[model samples]
Target chain A: MQANRSRFLTIMLTLGLAFFYVPMILLVIYSFNYSKIVPVWGGWSLRWYRELFESAEVWSAVTLSLQIAFVNATFATMLGLLAGLAMVRFGRFRGRTLFGGMIVAPLVMPEVITGLSLLVFFISLNQLTGWPAERGFTTITIAHITFSMAYVAVTIQARLTGMGEDLEEAAADLGARPLKVLTAITIPRLTPALISGWLLAFTLSLDDLVIASFVTGPGSNTLPILIFSRIRTGLRPDINALATIVILVISICVAIAAILMFRQQRAEMRDQKMAEGADE
Target chain B: MTASNSVSATPWSDTDGQKPLVELRGVTKKFGDVTAVDNIDLDIYAGELFCLLGGSGCGKSTLLRMLAGFESLNSGSIKIDGVDMSDVPAYDRPTNMMFQSYALFPHMSVAKNIAFGLQQDRVPKNDIADRVQDILKLVELQDYGKRKPSQLSGGQRQRVALARALVKQPKLLLLDEPLAALDKKLRKHTQFELANIQEKVGVTFVVVTHDQEEAMTLSSRMAVMDAGRLQQIGTPTEVYEFPESRFVADFIGSANIFEGRVTEDGADHVRVQTDVCDVFIDHGQSVKEGGKIWVALRPEKIHITKSDTPVTGENQVSGVVDDIGYLGETSIYKILLPNDQIIDVTAPNQTRPMNRQHLITWEDKVNISWEPSSAMLLTS
Candidate 1:
C-alpha cells in the first residue's frame, strides 16, 4: 500500500512540474524552427535568431530598456533608501502612518489604474506648467521609478528594521557622531540590503509594460513595450527567439546567484567551525 | 548585625574625599505612565567598580543608559568629571558602553572595529593601529585582529566588544550584562578576567547585571534596585548580612522572615515577638514601643541538633523534622514547629553520610538556635 501511494505521489509531482515548464520548453524548441509563423514548426534551423540579431528596432529597444532600468534603479534606490530610513528612524513624526501607507500603496495598486492615473497626472501637470516639452524616455523612466521605488523601499525597510539600532548606538557610544556612524557603521552594514533593493528596482523597471506604454511617446519603445506591440499584431518567430534568449540569460543569472549563495554558506560554516575549534 | 570591614585594603577607599567621577541628582525617567527610574541620587567614585544589580524590569539598564547619554532625564542633572552633561550627546559624553548583545560589527574585522572610534576622531593611522593592537593584547585577542566577528567564539566576540570600547579609553566605561551571554563555566572565568582588565585600565566601571553572584564578584560596591527605586547600596557583605528591608533580604539570598510587634527597643539591643518565637537583635533599631516589625533569619546561621535536651529562648525554636534535602556540602531540614509553622534550617555536613542518611531525618525532633546578632530586624 505504501509503495503504491509513493508511486502515485511521484507521478503527481512530475505532472505539476511539467505543467509549469512545458510551455516554456515548447517555446524554446520552436525558436529553432525554420518557419515564418509560430504555430507551424519547420525543420530545426537558426533562421529566426539571425533575423532577430539583424533587427535594429530590437537593438534600439534593448538599449533604451537597459538605459531606463539602470537610471531608474539608481534613482529609485536613493529615494527609497531615504524613505525607508526616515520611516524607521525618524521616530514617530507627524503623518507617519500616512507616509508609510502611501509608500507601499503602489505595490497593491492595479496596473491599469496606476497607468491611467499617472497619464492623467502628467497631462494635467504639462497643461498647467508647460513642462516636459515631450514625453518619451524621460517620462517613461520617471513613471517606472514611481512604482519601482515601492519594492525597493519595502525591501530596504524590512532589512533596516531587522538590523536594529544596536550597531548604530554602539558606534555612537564609541564616540562617532551621527554622520560618522552612518558612514562608518550603518551604510557598510546595509550594503547587502542596498544591493538587493537596487536589483529589485532594476528588474521591476525592466518588466514594466503598461505604465511605460502610457507614459511613452513616439519612437521611445522599451523592450517589453516593443515585444507586446509586436505580439498584438501577431506572434513572430523572431519574438519567440528573443524570448528564448531572455529566458536563457535570466536562468543563467539565477544559477550563478544560487552558486554564489551556496559558496557563501559553506564559507560561513567553515568560519563557525574555525571559531569553535579555536576554543578547544 | 550590619556587615562592616568590606573587601579589605582597596586603593579606592570612600574616605579619600576625592570628587566623584560621576554624580547624578534626582535622575528620573518615565515611559508614559510607568516610571522606569524615579528620583535617583547616586555618586560613583573614580577607579571604583560599581554594579547596579536587579531583576528584570527594574530599570537598572535604564539608569546605565542615562549615564551613557543614550537616555535623557525627565527632571534631573548628571555630571561627569565635574562637567555638567545635561545637553551632551552620546558621542560628546566621555563615556563608552559594552552592550549586552556585544553588538560587534559583523562586517568589520576585529582591528577595524576597535579602530573605528579612533578613526572618528581623525587620529593618526599609526596611533590608531597601535592602540587597537594594545587593547587587543589586553583582551588577549591580538592573534585574531584580521578575523571577522563571526569567525570568533562567544567569549572572543565579547572580548572584541570590550576591546572596541576600551580602545577609546573613555573617562567612564559602562558594561551592560557583559557576561550574561556566555555559558556557566565561561561566565565564571570571564568574570575574574573582566575585573582584572578593569583594574589594569583604571577606568571607572559602571556594570549593570541581574546575576547577584556576578555583581558580588565583580563590583567593589553594588546597588540593589527594585521597581524603579534603589532598595539598598553597599558592599555585598553588608547587603547580604544586614539587609535594610524585607525585599533586599529576600532578593539577595534565602531568608526566613517572621512578622511580630516589638516587645522592647533598648539602646544596645531589641526584642520582637513573632508567630513561632521571640527574636532578639544585638543592635537596636528606632521603633515605637508596640509597633509591628519583621525579623529575617538566615538558614545557615541557625544551629540544628537532635532534640535530647529541651531548649527555650527568644532566638530559639523546637520543631520536628519534616524533610531533609541532601546537598553536596550542606543539608537542609524543613522543620515543622509546634505552632504548625514550617521553617528552613541548613547545617554544614561535617561528616559524610552513609546510605544517603544524615543525622537529621524525617520525623526527628530537633532544637534550632541562632545567636541574637543573627536575627535582622526589619521595621519597614
Candidate 2:
C-alpha cells in the first residue's frame, strides 16, 4: 500500500510540474526556431534573437522598464520600510487603522480599479497644480511604487515582527539613541528582509501591465506595455525571443538568490553546531 | 513583640546614614486599568548588588525597567547619583541593562558589541579598542572577541551581554533575569561570576529575578515584590528567618504555617492556638490578643523523631508520617496530625541507610518539635 501511494504521488508531482513548466519550455524552444511562423519547427537558429536586438523600439522599452523598476524599487522599499516599522514597532497611533488599511488596500484592490483611480487622481492633480503636465515615465513609476510597496511592506512586516524589540531596547540601554539604534542595530539586522523586499518590488514593477497601461503616455513605453500592445495584433518570433531572454535572466537571478540564501542557512547551522560543541 | 524592635532585630543591611546611589520616590506605573507597579519607594546603596525578586507579573521587571529609564513613571521621580531622572532618556541615563534574552547584537563581533556603548559616547578609537579588550579579558572570552554572538554558546552569549552592558561603566547596571536562560549547573556558576564582577567593577547592580534561590545567593539585599507591591526588603537571612508577611514566608522557601488566633502577646514571646496544638513564637509582635495570626516554621527547623521517643519542647506536635521524599542530601517528611492538618518537615540525612529501611518510614508515627526561637509570628 505504501509503495502504491508513493507511486501515485510521484505521478501527480510530475504531472503538476509539467503543467507549469512545459509551456515555458516550449516557448523557449520555439525562440530558437528559424521559421517565420511560430508553430513551424525549422532548424535551430538565432534569427529571431538578432531581429529582436536590432529593434530600437524593443530596446527603448526595455530601457524604460529598467529605469522605472529601478526607481520604483528604491522608493517603494524606503516607503515600505517606514510603513513596516510603524506597524510593527510603533506601539499605537490615532490613525493607525486608517494608515494600515491604506497601506494594504493596494494589495487586495483590483488592478483595473487601482489604475483607473490613480489615473483620475493624477489628471485632477495636474489640472489643479499644472504639475506632471503629461503622464509618462514619472506617472508609471509613481503608480508602480504605490502597488509594489504593499508587497514590500508585507514582507518587511513579517521579518520585523519576528525580530523582537529586545535587541533595539538593548541597543538603547547600551547608550545608543533611537536614531542611532536604528542605524547601528535595526537596519543592519534587517538586511535580509530589505534585500528581498527590494527584489520583489523590482520584479513586480517590471511585470506590471494594467497599471502601466493606464498611467503610461507617449514616449514612455515599458517592456510589458509594448509586448502587450504587439500581442493584440499577433504573436511574433521577435517577441518570443525577447520573452526567452527575460525568462533566462529571471531564472539566473532566482538561482543566485537561492544559492545565497542556502549559503546563509548553512553558515547559521555551522555556527549553531559550534555553539553546541562549545557548550558541551 | 513590638514592630520597631523586630525591624532592628532582622539581619539585613541597614542603610541608616549612607547616601543611596539610586532612589525612587512614590514611583507608580499603570497600564490601562491595571497597576503594573504601585506606589513604591526604594533606596539602593552605592556599590550594592541589590535584587528585585518576584514571580511573573509581580512588577519586579517593570520596576527594573523604570530604573533603567526604559519606562516612564506615571507619577513619581527616580533619582540616580543625586540627579532627578524624570526627563532623562534611556540613552542619556547613566545606566545599562542586560536583557533577559541577552539581546546581543547578532551582526557584530564580541569586540564590536563591547565597544558599541563607547562608540555611542564618542570615545576615542584607541580607548574603545582598549576597553573592549579589557572587557573581553574580564569575561574570560579574550580569544572569542572576533566571534559573533551566534557563534557563541548560551553561557558565552550571556557573558557577552554582561560585557556589553558593563563595558559602558555606567553608574548603575540593571540585569533582568540575567542567568535565567542557562541550565541549572551553568546558572549556579554564572551567579557567583556575576556577583564577583559587580564587586570588581564597584557598580551598583539591580537585578530582577523570579527565582528565590537565585535572589538569595546573588544579592546582598533583595526586595520581594508581589501583586505590584513591595512585600519586604531585607537580606536573605532576614527574609528567610523572619518574613514580614505570610506571602514572604511561603514564597521564600518551604514553610509549615499554622493558622490560629493569638492567645498571648508578651514582650519576649507570643503564643497562638491552632487546630493541631498551641504554637509558641520566640519574638514578641504588635498583634493584639484574640486577633487572627499565623505561626510559620521553616521545614528544616523542625526536628523529627520516633513517636515513642520522649521529647519535651515548647513547640511540639505528634503525627504520623504521611510521605517521605528522599532528596540526595536531605529528606522531606509530610506529617499528618490528629486534627487532619499536614505539616512538612525536612531533615538532613547525615548517615546513609544500609538497608531499604529509612529512619522515618511512611505511615510511621513521629513527633515533630521546633524551638520557640525558630518559630515566626506573622499577622497581616
Candidate 3:
C-alpha cells in the first residue's frame, strides 16, 4: 500500500505540473504553423516570426513595456530598500505594526481593485493639478511601482532581519564615521538582499497586464496590454509568436540568474569547509 | 579602623606616576527603568591592564560600553587622557572596542578589514597598504591576508579582529570578554599572547570577563562588581589576601567563613569567639565590645594532620576527616569540627608513600591549624 501511495503521489504531481504548462507549449507550437487555423498539422515555417519583427506597432509596444519596467523596477527597489532598512534597524513604535500591514496590503488585495483605485487617483490628481492630463507611460509606471514594491519590501526585510548588526559596530570601533560604516560594511553585506529585491520587482513589473491596461493611454500600450487586446480580437499567429518570444526571454534570464546564485552558494560552502579544515 | 582619617592618599607628582588615562566621576547609566551602571568613580592608570570582573548582569560590560562611548552616561562625567569624553560620539572618541563576537566583516578580506579604518580616514593608498601589512604581521596573519573571515578559524578570526581594532592605534582598547569564545586550551595560550601585545604596544587595555582566574592572571589592577555597583578595586594580591567584604572574598576564591563575636580588641589585632573555633584574626578593622563579626580563611592557609599538633603561635582545632579530593599538585581535605562545621584544608602533594595510614580517610580524626594573620575580618 505504501508503494502504491508513493506511485500515486508522484503521478499526481507530474499531472499538475503538465496541466500548468500544456497551454503555453501548445501556443508555442502553433506560432510556427503555416496554416492560419487551429489544431491542424501544417508544414512549419518562420513566417509568423518574420511578420512579428516587421510590425512597427508591435515593436513600439515592446519598447514602451521595456522602458516602463526598467523605470518601475529602479524606483520600486529604492523605496523597498529604504523601507526594509527602517523596519529592521529601528525599534517598533505606536502604529508601527499597522504601518507595516498597510505597506504590504497591495500584495494581497485584489488586482482589479488596485487598478481601479489607481485610475481614479490619477484622474483626481490631473483635475486638481493640471498635470498628467491623461493616463500614459508615467501613470502605468507609477501603478506598477506601487504594487510591485510590496514584494520587494518583504523579500528584502527577511534578509535584513537575519543579517547580524555586529559588522557595523566593528566598523565604527575601527574609527569609521557613521556614513562610512554604512557604505563600507552595511551596503556590502546587503548586496544579496538588494539583488533579490531588484529581481522580484522587475518580474512583477513585467507580468502586469490589468493595471497597465487601466492606466495606459492611446499610443502607450505595453506588451501585456497589447497581447490582451489581440486576444480579444481572436488568437492570431503574431500573438502566439510574441508569447513564445516572451517565454524564451524570461527563461533565459531566470536560468542565468539561478546559475549565478548557485555558484555563489558553492563558493560560500567551500570557504566554510576550508575554515573548518584549518581549525582541526 | 579608618586609617589616618583620610579618604584617599594624594600623590606628589601627577605626570611622574601619571594620572589614570581614563577617569570617571560618579558616572551612572540608566536604561529606561533599569539602572545598568550605578554611580561609579574610577581611575584607570596609563599602560596598565585593568579588568572588571563579575557575573552576568553585574554591569561590568555596561561600564565598559560606557567607556567605549557606545552608551551615554546618565549623570556625571568621563575623561580620557584628561580630556572629557561626554560629548564625543563613538566615531569621534579615541577609543576602540573588541566585541565579544569578534565582529569581523564577512565579505572583506583580512587585509581589507584591517585597512578599513585607515581608508575611512582618507589616508593615502600606499600608506594604507603598508599599515595593513604591518598589522597583519603583528597578528601573525601575514599569509592569510587575502582570505575572508569565513575562511579563517575561530582563533585566526579573533586575531584579525584584534589587528583591525589596533591598526589605528587608539589611546585605549576596550575588550568585552575577548577570550570567551575560544576553547580552554586556546584561551590559555591567547591570554598570554594578548598580555604580551599590550606590553609591546604600550597602550592601556581594559578587559571585561567573568572568569576570576583570567582576571587575576592578566590584570595589574582589577575591579570586582555586583548588581551594577563596584564592590572593590585593588591589585590581585590585595583582593585575594585581604578582601574588604564577604562578597569580594567569596567571589574571588573559595574561603571558609565563620560568624563570630569580638572577645578582645588590641592595638593591631583582634580575637573572635567563634562557634566552631575560637580563632584569632589579625585584620585591621575596628570592632567594638560585644560586636558581631566574620572571619574568612583561605583553604591553603590551613594545614591538616592526622593527629593533634601542639602549636604556640597559631590557632588549632581537632576534627574528623569528612572527605578528600586529590588534585595533582595539591590535596583538599574536609575536616568536620565538633560544632558540626566542615573546614577545608589544602595540603601540597609533595613526596609519596611517607606514611601509609595518614593518607586521609573519611571520618578519620584530624587537626587543622593556621597563622593568626591568615584570617581576614569582614564587618560588612
Candidate 4:
C-alpha cells in the first residue's frame, strides 16, 4: 500500500512540473527553427537569433526597458527606505496611520486601476501646468516607480521592525550621536534589506507589461510593450528567439544568485564552527 | 561583599562633606495612563555598587533608564557630579548602560564593540586599540577579541557587553538585569565576578534586577521598589534581618508573618501575643499595651524539638508535627498548633537516620522555640 501511494505521488509530481514547463520548452525549441512560421518545425538553425539582434526596433526596446527599470529601482529604494524608517522609528507622527495604509495600497490594488489612474493623473497635470507634456519614458517610469516602491516599502518595513530598536539604543548608549548612529549603525545594518528591496523593485518594473502599455506613448516601446503589440497581430519566430534569449539571461542570473548564496552559507558555517571549536 | 572590602558597614559611609556621585530628586515617569515610576529621591555614594530591585512592573528599570537619559523624567531633575542632566541627551550623558539583552553588535567583532565608545569620543586609533586590549584582559576575554558575538557563548557575550559599557570609564554604569540571561549555576558564578570587576574599576554601578538574591549578593546597599514607590533602602543585611513592613518581610525571603497584639513593653524586651504563640522580642519597640502589631519569623531561626513534656512559656510553643518535607540539606516541619494554626520550622540534616528510619515521624508532638531576637516585630 505504501509503495502504491509513493508511486502515485511521484507520477503526480512529474505531471505537475511538466505542466508548468512544457509550454516554455516548446517555445525554446521553436526559437531554433529555420522556418519563419512559429508552429512549423524545420531543421534547427540560429537564423532567427541573428535577425533579432540585427533589428533596430528590438535594440531600442531593450535599451528603453533597461533605462526604466534602472531608474525605477533607484528611486523606489530611496523612497521606500525613508518610508519604512518613518513607519517603524518615527513612533508617532502626524498621519502615521493614513501613511501606513496608503503605502501598501499599490500592492493590493488592481494593476489596471493603478495604471488608469496614473495615466489620468499625468494627462491632468500636463493640462494644468504644461508639464510632462509627452507621455513616453517619463510617464511609464513614474507609473512603474509608483507601484514598485510599495513592494520595496513592505520589504523594508518588515526588516526594520524585525531588527528592532536594540541596535540603535546600543549605539546611543555607546555615545554615538543621533546622526552618527544612523550612519554608523542603522544604515549598515539595513544593507541587506536595502539590497533585496532594490533588486525586487528592479525585477517588478522589468516584468511589468499592462502598466507600461497603459502609460506608454509615441517612441516609447519597452521590450514587453513591443513584444505584446507584435504578438497581438501574429506569432513570429524572431519573438520566440527573443523570449528564449530572455529566459537564458534569467537562468544565468538565477545560477549566479544561487552560487553567491551557497558561498555565503559556507562562510557562515565556518564562522559557526570556529566559534564552537575555539578553545580560547 | 568582596567589592565592599570594608570592615565598616560601607566604604563610603564617611562622606561627611562630599557630594553624592548621582542624585535623583523627585524623579517621576508616566507611560500614557500608567505611572511607571513615581516621585523618588535617591543619593548614591561614589565607588559603591547600588542595586534597585523589584518584581516586574515595579518601575525599577524606568528609574535606571532615566539616569542613563534614555527616558526623560515627567517631573523633577537628575544631577551627576553636580551638573543638571535634564537637557543632556542619552548619547552625551556621563552614564553608560549595559542592556539586559547584552545588545552587542552582532556585525562587529568583540574588539570593535569595546572600542566603539572611545571612537565616538574621537580618541586616537592607537589609544582606542590599547584600551580595548586592556579591557579585554580585565574581562578575561583577551583571546576572544577577534570573534563575533554570535561565535561566542552566552557568558562570553555577557562579558563583551560589560567590557563595552565599562571601557568608556563613565562616572556611572547602569546595568539592567545583568545576570538574568544566564543559567542558574552561571548566574551565581557571574554575580561574584561582576562585583569583583566593579571593585577593580572603582566606578559607581547601579544595577536593576528582579532577583532578590542577585541584589543581596551583588549590592553593598540596595533599594527595593513596589507599585512604583520606594519600599526600603539599606544595606542587604539590614533589609534581610529587619524589614520595616510586612511587604518587605514577605518580599525579601520566606517568612511566617502573623498579626498579634502587644501584651507588655519593657526596657529590655517586648512581648507580643498571637493566635499561634507568644513572641518575646529582644529590643523594646514603641507600642502601647494591648496595641495591635505584626510579627515575622524566619523558618531557619526557629528550633523544632520532639518532646511530650507540654512546654509552655514565652518564645515557646507545643504543637503536633503535621507534615515533614525531607529536603536533602534541610527538612521543613509544618507544625499544627492547638488553635489550628500552621507554623513552619526548618532544621539542618546533619545526622542520618539509622536503618531506614526517620528522625521525626508524622503526628508527633513537638516543642518549637526561638531566641528573643529571631522574631521580627512589624508594626506596618
Candidate 5:
C-alpha cells in the first residue's frame, strides 16, 4: 500500500508540473523555428531573434516599458512606505479608515475600470489644469504606480505589523528623537521588506497590459501593448521571440529575488538558532 | 569606610542635607474609563535603587512609563532635580529605560547600539566611541561589541541593553521587569549584578517588577501596588515584617491571617478575640475597641512541637498535622485546629534523622506557638 501511494504521488506531481511548464516550453521551442507558418516547424534557427532585435518598434516598446517600470517602482515604493507607516505606526487620526480604504481600493478594483477611470480623469485634468498635455508615457507610468503602490503598501504593512514596538521605544528612551528613531531603528529593520516591495511594483508595472493600453498615446506603446496589438493581426515568430525574451527576463528577476529571500531566511534562521541556544 | 561615613556612603541616605532627586505629587493617569495610576505621592532620593512591585495591570509599569515621560499624567506634577518634568518629552527627559525585552537593535552590532544614543545627541565621534567602550567594559560585554543582538546570548543581550542605556549617563535609569526574562539560576545571579551596577554607578534606579523576590533583593525601598493604588511603601524588611494592609501581607509572601475583633486596647499592647484563641499583639495599633482586624503571622515565625512538650502561651494552639511538605532545607506543616483553621508552620531542617522517616510524621498532634511580637495587627 505504501508503494502504491508513492507511485500515485510521483505521477500526480509530474502531471501538475507538466501542466504548468508545457505551454512555456512549447513557446520557447517554436520561437527558434525558421518556419514562416506557425505549427509547421521546418528547422530551428535564430532568424526570429535577429528580426526581433532589428525592429525599432520592439526596441522602443521595451525601452518605454523599462522606463515606466523603473519610475513606477521608485515612486510607488515611496508612497507605499508612507502609507504603510501611517497605517502601522501612527496612532488613530481623523479619516484614518477612509484613507485606508482609498489606499486599498485600487488593489481590488477591476483593471479595465481603473484604466478607463484614469483615462477620463487625466483628460479632465488636462482640460482644467493643462498639466499633462497629452496621454503618453507619463499617463501610463502614473496608472501603473496607482495600482502597484497598493501592492507595495500591503507588503510593507504586513512587515511593520510583525515588528515589535520595543525597539522604537528603546531608541526614544536612549535620547533619540522620533525622526532619529525612525532613521536608525525602524528603517534599517525594514530594508528587506522595502526591497521586496520595490521588486513587486517593478514586476507589476512591467507586466501591465490593459492599464497601459488605455493610458498610452501615440508613439508610447509599452511592450505588452505592442505585443497585444500585433497579435490581433496574425501570429509572428518575432512576437514569439519577444514573448520568450519577456519570460526569460521575468524568470531571471524572479530567480534573483528568490536567491535574495533565501539568503535573508538563512540569516534569520541563524539568529533564531542563536536565540534558541541562549534559551537553553 | 568608617561608621559615620558608611551611614552616608550612599547619596540617598544623606537626607540630612541632600534634597530628593525625583518627586511625584498626586500623580494620576486615566485610560478611557479605567484609572491606570491613581493619585500617588512619592519622593525618591538621589542614588537610591527603588522598585515598584505589582502584578500585571496593577499600574506599576504605567507609573514607570509616566516617570520616563512616555505617558502624561491626568492631573499631577513630576519634578526631577527641582525641574518640573510635566512638559518634557521622553527624548528630552534626563532618564533612560532598559526595557524588559532588552530591545537591542537586531540590525546593529552591540557597539553600534550603545553608540546610537550618543550619536543622536550629535556627540563627537571620539567621545561617543570612548563612552561606548567604557560602558561595554562596565557591563562586561566588551568582547561582544561587534556581534549583533541576535548573535549574542540572552544574558549578553541584556548587558548590551544596559550598556546602551547607561552610555548616556542619564540622571535616572528606569528598568521594567529587568530580570524577569532569565531562568531561575540566571535571574538570581543577574539580580545581584543589577544591584551592584546600580550601586557602582550611583544613578537613581527605579525598577518595575512583578517578582516579589526580585524586588525584595534589589530594591533599597519598594512600593507595593494593587488595583492602581499604592498598598504600602517601605524597605524590604518593613514590608515583610510589618505589612500595612492584608493585600500587602498576602502579596509579598505567604501569611497565615486570623480574623478577630479588638477586645482590649492598651497603650503598650492590644488584645484581640478570635474563634480559636485570644491573640495578643505586643504593640498598640490605632484599632478601636470591638473593631474588626486581621492578625498575620508568618509561617517561619510559628514554632511547632510535639503536644507532650510543655509550651504555655496565649498565642499557642494545638492541632493535628494534616500535611507535611518536606523541602530540602525547610519543612512546612499544615496543622488543622479544632475549629478547622489550617495554620502553616515552617521549620528549618537543622539536623537530619538517621532513618528515612520524617521528624514529624502524619497525624501527629503538634502544638503551634508564636510570640506576641511576631503577630502583625493589620486593620484593612
Candidate 6:
C-alpha cells in the first residue's frame, strides 16, 4: 500500500510539472513550425523567428520596454533604498508606521487601481503645472516606478532589518561621520539586496501591461502591451517565437545567477576550511 | 597621549591628574514611567577598565548608551574630558562604542568595514587604507580583510568590531557586553586581551555587562546597579570583601546570610544572636544597641570537621551533614542546624578516603565555624 501511494504521488508531481510546462513546450515546438497555425505542428522551420526579427513594431516596442524598465528600475530602487533605510533606522517619529504601510500598500493592492490612480494623479499634475501635457513614455515609466518601488522597498527592508546597527556604529567609531557610515558601511552592506531589488523592479516594469495601457500615449507601447494587442488580433506564430526567446533569456539569466551563487558558497567553504587548518 | 607607568591609579594621563575621561553628575534617564537610569553620579578616569555590572533592566545598558550619546539625559550633565556633552549628538560624540551584537557590516569586506569611519571623516584615500591596514594588523585580522562579515566566525567578527572602534582612537571607548557572545573559554581569553588593549591604548574603557565574573576579572573599578539606581561602585576586592548592602553582597558572589540581633558591640568586634547560632562580626562601621543586622559568611570561610577541637572563634555551630556536592576542586557540604537552617561549607578535595567505613555519612554531626573577621555586617 505504501509503495502504491508513493507511485501515485510521483505520477501526480510529474503530471503537475508537465501540466505547467506543456504549453511552453508546445510554444517552443511551434515557434519552429513551418505553418503559421499553432497546435498543429508542421515540419520544423524558423519562418516565425525570421518574421519576428523583421517586424519593426515588435523591435520598437521591445526597445521602448527596455528603456522604460531601466528608468523605472533605477528610480524605484533609489526611492526604495531611502524609504527602507528611513523605516528601519529612524523609526521613532509619529505616523512612521502609517507611512511605512503606505509605501508597501501597492504590493498588495490591485495593479488596475494603481494604474488608474497614477493616471489621474498625472493628469492633475499636468493641469496644475502646465507641464507634461502628453502622457506616454514618461507617464508609463512613472507609473511602473510607483508600483515597482513597493517590491524594492520590501526586499530592502528585510535586508536592513537583519543588517543590525553595529556596522554603522562600528564605522562611526572608526571615525566615519554619519554620511560616510551610510555610504561606506550601510550602502555597501545593502548592495546584494539593492541589486536584487533593481532586478525585481526591472522585471516587474517589463511585465507591466495594464498600467502601460492606462498611462501610455500613442507610439509608447511596451512589449507586453504589444504582445497582448497582437494576441487579440489573433494568435500569431511570431508571438510564440517572441515568447520562446523571452522564456529562454529569463531561464538562462536565472540559471547563471544560481551557478554563481553556488560557486560563491563552495569557495567560502574552502576558505573556511583553510582558516580552520591555520588555526589548528 | 602616553600613559605614566606609575602604579598610583594614574593609568591614563590627564593634565595635573585633575580631569577624568568621562564624568556623569546626577545623570538620570527616564522613559515615560520607567526610570532606566536614576540619578547616576560617576567619575571614570582615563585608562581604567570601568565596568557597569548589573542584571537585565538594571540600567547598566542605559548608562552606557547615555555615555555613547545615543540616549538623552533627563537630568544632570555628562562631561567628556571636561567638555559638557548635554546637547552633543551621537554622531558628534568623541567616544566610540562597541555594540553588544558586534555589528560588522555584512556586505563589505573586513577591511572596508574597518575603513568606513575614515571614509566618513573624509580622510584621504591613501591614509584610510594605511589606517585600515594598521587596525587589521592590530586585531590580527590582516589576512581576513577581504572576507565579508557573514564569512567570519563570532570571534573574528568581534575582533573586527574591536578594530573598527579602536581605529578611531576616540577619547573614550564603550563596550556593551563585549564578551557576552563568546563561549566561556573564549570569554576568559578575550577578557585579558581587552584589558591589554585598554592598557596599550591608554583610553578610558567603560564596559557594561551582567556577567559578574567578567566584571570582576576585567574591571579596575566596577559599579553594581539595581532597579535603575547605582548600588555600589568600588574595586572588585573592595566590593567583594566590604559590601555596603545585602544586594551588593548577594549579586557579586554567593554568601550565606543569617538574620541576627546585636547582643554585644565593641570597637572592632560585635556579637550578634541569631535564631540558630551566635555570630561575632568584625566591621569598621558602628552599630546601635539592640539593633537588628544581617551577618554574611562566604561558603569557603565556613570550615567543617567531624571532631570538635578546641576552637578559638567566637561563633560555632554543630549540625548534621545533609548533603555533599563534589565539585571539581572542592566538596560542598550542606549542614542542617537544629533550627532548620542549612549552612553550606566548601572544602578543598585534598584527601580521598579509601574505605567505605571512613566515608562521611548523611547524618554525621559536623562542626561549622568561621573567624569573627570573616563575617560581614549588612544593615537594612
Name the regions of candidate 1 deviating beyond 4 angstroms.
Answer: B1-16, B308-310, B354-356
Error of 3 at A32 (Å): 4.7
Query: Which has the greatest lDDT?
Result: 4
Q: Candidate 1 or 6, higher TM-score?
A: 1
> Candidate 6 — what's its lDDT?
0.85
TM-score of predicted model 3?
0.88
Q: What is the lDDT of residue A132 in candidate 6?
A: 77
DockQ of 2: 0.86
Q: Considering the two chains of model 2, state its CAPRI-style docking category.
A: high
Listed models, DockQ each: 0.83, 0.86, 0.64, 0.60, 0.62, 0.38
True contacts kept of 4: 0.58
Worst 10 residues of 4 chain B by lDDT: B3-12
Candidate 6 chain B minimal-lDDT segment of 10 residues = B6-15
Question: Per-candidate interface C-alpha RMSD?
Answer: 0.9, 0.9, 1.3, 1.6, 2.2, 3.0
Question: What does candidate 2's lDDT look like per residue over A1-280, in tens digits?
Answer: 9999999999999999999999999899999999988889999999999999999999999999999999999999999999999998888899988988888999999999999999998999999999789999999999999999999999899999999999999889888989999899889989989998999999999999999999988888999999989888877788899999999999999899889889999999999998988773
Candidate 3 CAPRI category: medium
Q: What is the C-alpha lDDT of each candidate?
A: 0.89, 0.90, 0.85, 0.91, 0.89, 0.85
Better of 4 and 5 by TM-score: 5
Query: Which lDDT tens digits does candidate 1 get at residues B192-220?
Result: 99999999999989999999999999998
RMSD of 4: 2.7
The C-alpha stretches of model 6 lying farther than 4 A from their native spots are B1-7, B10-17, B106-157, B308-314, B352-361
lDDT of 3 by residue, B103-188 (tens): 88888888988888888778999999999999889889898999989999999999988888888888999999999999999999
DockQ of 3: 0.64
Tens digits of per-residue lDDT for model 1 on A106-223?
Answer: 9999998898898888889899998677788888888889998998889889988999998999999888888888788878878888888888888899899889888888899999
Which segments of candidate 2 are over 4 A away from where they belong? B1-16, B309-313
Q: Estimate each model's TM-score.
A: 0.96, 0.96, 0.88, 0.94, 0.95, 0.92
Write down the worst ten-residue block by lDDT for model 1 chain B: B1-10
Is 5 or 6 the stronger prediction by DockQ?
Answer: 5
What are the clashing pairs of model 3? B1-B286
Q: By TM-score, is 4 or 6 better?
A: 4
Pairs of residues clashing in candidate 6: A166-B103, A167-B103, A176-B117
lDDT of 2 at B32: 93
